[model samples]
Target: MTLKGQHLELLPVDSPEYKKHINKFKDLHLINLYKIHYTGADKNNNSDDSWSDPIYFHGTGHCGCIDRHIERRTGSVRISVSEWCQHDDGCETRGILLQGHCREHSLHEGRHYFSEDIEVALKYAADGLQEHVASDNLSNKARFSLFLCKARNIHLGHEAMHRYVVSDYDIIPCYLVIVCRQL
Candidate 1:
């Protein structure tokens, strides 16, 4: 799906930015490195100040396959409410989550969640891959295409122990790093 209301600048592989930032992740094939341009409301104007220090990693449940990732289509690079919670009361909870009103629960306080550990983020991506692959019955060729795409596509972070819970206003997806796990 085409990204609406967002502009992603794909970085070249030989670029200094890609080499310095993306080359650290070993065993993961680079698919794309996009500098995210968020069009969402910046209540504190932190996007400009914090764009260079995007040391945090957000697990988007994407297995590095661009074709299957839905969150990338949004300007905020965030999943919609319906795509977030699948419970029976999701319709009602959607509003609360969207408004950043989920302060009742400690874990659900923020609208977005991120991790500092790349491995943890990768685990989420792998888990998502399982779910995605299981839901569909694709042929071997299709599965190969997913990995092959990772092999191609030339384009192409910091220290924190805790998970980051960002509010809707302060949340801005600074970059999009797409990497496929080497099997």
Candidate 2:
């Protein structure tokens, strides 16, 4: 189960075949557990006051939580939270979509209207991490850690890359998970 030192390829998400697979998985309401790792670069990464690392669980009827953690070496703090599944039309495809929410305004549009770019960025990061995991030669534990680290880095980089595109943005180093029911 360790991803260390394995060679993984970044799969294209825009393929028609992949979309079909995702729709099928969604229709089945399959729940999957994923480990999303992120650095504690900011102080408000977690929804809870504990300031622990942010880990999220995604599935049907799953409520996401935000956890915060502090890094010892940098003395910096960060917070991360799981996306909420609202009952509005927006909750159709983006399950627990994690991203910066509009604090002042409530836009009840579909999940597609939210931050699609962020999701795409996350996919890129995940793909990069997967590839690194597939190519590296390390212990299972080490490989897992490296995968997490790379994923976090890629996620953060995406945020930085698109900071100006979004509003009310507080870019925190974080990762996202889109688990497949079959896997």
Candidate 3:
């Protein structure tokens, strides 16, 4: 299945093409993008060494978040928005990823705005996965995993920034995910 005039195909897992696509996604932008890897279980049979990539999503900029995990003995990847800014202090201008609302130049009176159209983001992510996977014959598990990864990546990539806020209405707690496709 194809959409938006782009032909998509799911390259083999861990293939050179797959690695290239992932790397390209990572290098797209420096803002709000985060990469996480789960090493393995600990002595207590619990996960360990799981941490967020140092790269933070800059407000209003496109970024990618990648995560790997195991559940029920199945491997999974998740990509999504990391976080959005609640303040406006030229932070968005500098493309630096940080937390907290800027009190001085409060865009929403120093309040963070949540996303309003998560479903749209989700669809976009699904489409992306479809393109990448490029095969209608993919297993449900593979498709589901791809959906999760794409959704997370889009969510994190399109997270709002202080600069994107043009009106007071843009500020809300709706949990908006980023969409890199737009970038």
Candidate 4:
């Protein structure tokens, strides 16, 4: 299927890529694996087009957001904007610091969150799937989703929590992973 000039290629179960990642998700049933080609502008419209590193396992509750992201290809940094300080001794600063919210991490709108660890991503995808299943009645089985992303810039902090915060065309969703819980 094509959306916003991007094409979604559904991989066959026997494809090498599927076989490569399927082992890691043995507990779940694979519904489909899609490889998305994003040819649109960066989500944030930033001119710095350098991709930093590839990150995996980004989970989202709404599938529409991915479509919207592909259509507009623009995103902004989502971080605490408090200048006077209040959140966890104030938000962490940039430079050699790697950049992240304080110990009390809070979700900021417009910011993309992800983790390098597949386990973390799986947990998030599972939670999102549960929500969808309950609200949309999409499936009786435990559903989960994971997005393989390319990050132009990544903010790593709170390693113990596996919270990777990025902003402004820094993160792009490239692959879609759909799985159902093993019965």
Candidate 4: list runs displaced more than 4 Å.
1-5, 41-54, 62-109, 135-140
| Model 2, residue 179: C-alpha shift (Å) | 1.6
Candidate 4 lDDT, 1-183, residue by residue in tens: 111223456666677877876775656676666665434443434245576444456764433222222222123212221211233432121100122122223244435567777767776655654543465665546445577766656665455545454443455555666666654
Q: How far in Å is the alpha carbon of 88 misplaced in model 3? A: 13
Q: Indicate whether candidate 2 or candidate 4 has the larger lDDT.
A: 4
| Model 3 C-alpha lDDT per residue in residues 105-180, reported as the tens digit of each score | 4444543322323343234335434543555733333311111111111122133421223322222111111223
The local distance difference test score of model 3 is 0.26
Q: Model 1 segments beyond 4 Å from truth?
A: 1-5, 40-44, 47-54, 62-65, 68-111, 135-162
lDDT of each residue in 1-183, candidate 1, tens digit only: 111223445566676767876754666666656554334334435435444253655444322235444234323344433343444332222222233222232233433344555666665445444544664543222211111000111111125432443333333444556665642
Report the C-alpha lDDT of model 2 over 1-183, residue by residue, as the tens digit. Answer: 111111112223553533433442332221221233323224333453442232221111111111111011132222222322333433311222332223332232211111223333333333433443453532222211111111111122234432211222322222333332122
Instruction: Tell how far residue 47 is off in model 2, in angstroms.
Output: 10
What is the Cα-based lDDT of residue 154 in candidate 4? 62
Select the stronger candidate by lDDT from 1 and 3.
1
| Pick by lDDT: 1 or 2, better one | 1
The Cα error of candidate 2 at residue 46, in Å, is 9.5
